[model samples]
Target: MNPFDPTVHLPDELLERIRERAPIHDRDNTFPEQDLEELRAAGYLSILVPAARGGAGLSLAQAAILQQRLASAAPATALAINMHLVWTGVAKVFSDRGVPGLEFVQDGAVAGEVFAFGISEAGNDLVLFGSDTEAAPTADGGYAFTGTKIFTSLAPVWTKLGLHGLDTTSPDAPKLVFAFVERTDAITTSDDWDTLGMRATQSRTTRLNGAVADAAHVVRRIDAGPGPDPIVFGIFSVFEILLASVYTGIARRAIDLAVHAASSRRSKKTGAAYSQDPDIRWRIADMGLAYDALPPQIAALARDVDERVDNGARWFVLLSGVKHRAITMAKHVVDQAMLVGGGGSYFSSNELSRLYRDVLAGAFHPSDPESAHATAASAWLGPLES
Candidate 1:
């Protein structure tokens, strides 16, 4: 087998096409179905599955880099695909650890089945540790999940929904059930995805009404509330790293645009290019300084996950910290780019304007500002007294 080359999987021509369509999707506030189809044809959806599983067999680190590149072209497209990659990445984690289960996920991906992440709930800050959804056991030893999932990206096209619900009627009673269910009649995806940015994602609200995950699809049954479950680690690690990659891509795009703007626009006062202006130079340099630190961080941490380097309790701290930093840094870079682009960027038609709105969605993702700070504080100082 050859070393994985991202360009082979995601060529520049494909990225340019996706970039060309990004503005249209954003303007129309629609899902990038064409982008999805193109990526699917490129075998991008199966990038993380093992080679024997008929995938690209790329490492999580490589996937992170590809995602960054994709995001630079179409941020919402990259973000929407992130959910699918998360499941495959988790499957890889299970495979590498010799853990049983999740082979179905790998098989499903190879078979061209789309998986949508269905864990987030409104106002559920416990994230991955607990669930408001109820998981009632069936006679067949499967489970029926009943709850609403928010921010369900790929709602329109996902064939499988990977979700979690709390089981209260079992012998152990109160086990968190992680399972996958087909998108059947029981699932309802609301058409309420209008937003300031990332409109192309179409990440709408999802309602699961007695949605069933058969015994074969039931992957995990563990005690709720913060245990050392590989599923938890898998989701958190892949999710945060990929998310950071997306925002880092946004920052990279913003810097590139700023560079273009600085070079093309000439200052009337000095009759020199804005790139020659000291203020613009400093601003661009500041953006570079901030942006330079992120990709390497994403690469290093993703490599750690791929190599299984044990950071133990610090894993969450590090994961959440990188995500937090990526979003903040990307936002700063985009803001600076907007200023550098001047009044023209304020128009809705400008790409920088779109990026400005798209970057805001990063803050709403998991490990939010408050949660990141809380995690770091607990890691540094002991948990606060009751």
Candidate 2:
């Protein structure tokens, strides 16, 4: 059986385990180490590593489906695993270039190695704030990476590192490199990531003082061109769509919990279950509508991407619009879920609350709703006035 087969890749028993442990993982504010280990062992980590490198060689859409299912089981673990998947895509982009560090990823995945992304930086409110982590040229045609990366998701558990940054001094450099590093070379600090949601991500700060970046560690030297990367555009589209999928799943779960809560608890006045209440019914209907609307939109966008890839066309406007729409839908659906779940929803024990928080992170990612909206608007109004 193909490891990339969506139906077979994510088995029911694995999802059940994730569902069972997610609550405790959230409460403990620790990384979902065990869940990720299971993912690695199951070959889910190599889903995008390319066929040439002994991977499933799945398309972006298939990977998105896996992420959505995983997110439904455990959003925190899903988010961390998404990073690994994204890095795998990065590694594949460089495989033809004979990048060395990626071999470590492939070998590690075969031997069960976990990787994490270090893009966000400290003293910067926005993640991907030009990467304070600097890479200074060394005497031996290599670079030395030094500085701290904040919000480094899955840092404590990750065995490999994928970093993004620019050569600040040489701003006009033609090439932008996304480097890979081993965990043994860097140090992870004890900085806490006790956020309101996705508490189990362990997205703490990691300080990499004098981490060496040899030629082999450099994954890809992307030519700094005018337009966005086609590969990146495809990846971003997948990511945005899956964010909606996960949010929709959470909303469905919330509705289920609400239904149970209402059925068991009766109001004293009319002796009717909460489910029978008109207000509760209305809220549930709203949740259902929001959940129902997402898949069609995602399908339309996925189809557009496939068409673009076939026609050799890059529809930046359409891609950006899809991202904007999906993120907005996710936020709206999650909010409606919270309302339907009621005050008890705020309690940590209520899984809806955790889902609510994790869903919020989706809107805050790179190519978020606001930026996507801007890109769409820009595309609509023609080129910028020089």
Candidate 3:
């Protein structure tokens, strides 16, 4: 059976189309342009925007499920689109909290404006803590961002970029300036996207040469590094939860592929299917054991964010932990499938092979294992003693 199916959010036909283009995009190391177009027209870009704002107004719990479904068919497409959704989700998070700062992002989604998250930078382990990009103040009370941003997904076509930088000149020295910059001549995208996997993402390097976010569009100017700001919490909660959903979906698909492989391929000596072998059955069971615990956890935590149930100081730990678990589960399932299916699964053209490569990317996303452990340790045992 096909692992991806029509859900309340995305139609089966849409999933089929996305599935079809995924391979071609991966083969060419190109962005999933077709997938983006389909998702945009399906009103998917507006799923997290408020209903009053001309959108479906989906909860984080609901979006997580839809993302998983989408990811099962094409992890790269799901992951690239995830960047766009992050901004919309952030907008909703603020609106839900009576903060209307990101209302423009909601409005942009309704009008088919693609927003790409651009917080990642070279050598910035601080994540949102700080930015090397310069956020120079303008005479009109806006900021001009001039620095490089890496791993900028949707680089070729994003209409607006949601980014942050360090504002050192202002009296609020070192405040991280969060704003939206429209794509224009000032921004340049590098063609250096070659990678090990998830090539369809085409997350190229972006250089912002005085890319300006006007006064009206600058959203936050809070002190950088981890803080009590709602925007930071909103970004961490939504990004990590949805990220976990994507990798979890990859594992779900790998399990299905393993089951199919076992059922059809016969063992020469026994004259029976691999599925009949006790060892093969056990391997499949192991995959299920790992995959089963994630969805409910993802959904429950997502709902917690939606309902504003305060996890307080534990929020970072919870989000990071879930992300780490999802990636680990996906990689384990793919590895087992490789062994279960034997030599055929080893081919570069094999779906499981591609998945194996794509799953490796999970380790690099924010709140990585070391950071997750550090956050959890700090939450439960306090910071390290000097």
TM-score of each: 0.99, 0.82, 0.98
lDDT of 1: 0.96
Which residues of candidate 3, in runs, are more than 4 Å off?
1-6
Off by over 4 Å in 2: 1-7, 50-52, 91-107, 122-130, 168-175, 222-245, 262-278, 299-320, 383-386
**If ranked by lDDT, best first, what sequence of candidates would result?**
1, 3, 2
Model 3 worst lDDT window (10 residues): 1-10
Task: Flag clash pairs in model 3.
Answer: 129-225
Q: How far does residue 157 in candidate 3 sit from its true spot (Å)?
A: 1.2
Q: Which lDDT tens digits does candidate 3 get at residues 108-133? A: 99999999989999889998889999
Write out the backbone clash pairs for model 1. Answer: none
User: Considering TM-score, which of the candidate structures 1 and 3 is the better prediction for this target?
Assistant: 1
- What lDDT tens digits, residue by residue, belong to model 2 across residues 146-244? 888776778787877877555555455534456777776556566578887777778887887777667766655454433355434534555455555
TM-score computed on alpha carbons, candidate 2: 0.82
